[model samples]
Target: MSLPFNNTCRFNSVFAGVLCTAALSIAPVAFADDGSEASRERALVIVTSDSLETQSMAMILSRAMQEQGSDLHLLLCDGAGDLAVEGYASERTVAPRDIKPEGLLATMMNDGAKVDVCAIYLPNSEYEQDDLREGVGVAMPGPMAEMMRDPKIPVYTF
Candidate 1:
């Protein structure tokens, strides 16, 4: 017996998730720094959530990491990509400092964070590459996947 087309797709997605989780679990751990040499921690922060609180928290945590000397590569997808769009402002402000996600994003970029939107963002959205703020780039899947698979560079998704 075979699953219906939609059911097959759902099954494939779930199976792929399980395999990826298993592979990650077995991948050898690589510390960001070794006593013999000095190296900053590298991280890939992927934010695809549309929720305001989620977006805010992602940026907050990323900022914390950067201040600690970690090298950050931000991959903004879905609605979160708007944070890179020039002249775009978030609706609500977050607590503790009363800054929105876009504000934190700007601060990180100023501090030399590498920020990029998923390549599909521009084509699907009403924005163009020119719409993005200076220093922001579009992420290509090949390079983004290489970052994700690098054991030394941990991936954090929200």
Candidate 2:
């Protein structure tokens, strides 16, 4: 016997839910490959805020992103560029562990995150190349623009 109209709709909805759940479970494996890192996830994190709290949160999230296996790329601009400066430290510290944003930034860098200062950071600021941390580089607009436009990679700004 055929089900009533409402029952049929209910059955269809249940079927669709199960189908979606199954697809979601397999989606991550679909992006994996054999021992190649190029296929791993990528994300660009831009920090331009001047607020200590904002900078603190940005570094916190960047750490989480790195921990999750994303190839984290950091673009520091404006006041946030201070994070790349050697010996730079914020007056206040974030709670839980009292670590400053600058300290957290260093930790993230040591954890393999790629770091760059915006192209104008040098010309607009008194700090020179020697002032920047050892591995931090000035970003080239050409490559940065390309990465920002890529569909598979996401960009997060704070």
Flag clash pairs in model 2.
Answer: none
Evaluate model 1: give its TM-score: 0.75
lDDT of 2 at 147: 99
Candidate 1: C-alpha RMSD to true structure equals 13.9
Off by over 4 Å in 1: 1-38
RMSD of each: 13.9, 4.5
lDDT of 1 at 96: 74
* TM-score (all chains, Cα) for each model: 0.75, 0.80
Error of 2 at 113 (Å): 0.5
The number of the candidate with the highest lDDT is 2
Pairs of residues clashing in candidate 1: none
As a whole number from 0 to 100, the lDDT of residue 117 in candidate 2 is: 99
What local distance difference test score does each model get?
0.91, 0.92
Best model number under TM-score: 2
lDDT of 1 by residue, 1-158 (tens): 45598899999999999999987876645443552323777889999998888999999999999998888999999989998999988887877788799999999999989999999999999999999999999999999999998899999999
In candidate 2, residue 95 scores what lDDT? 80
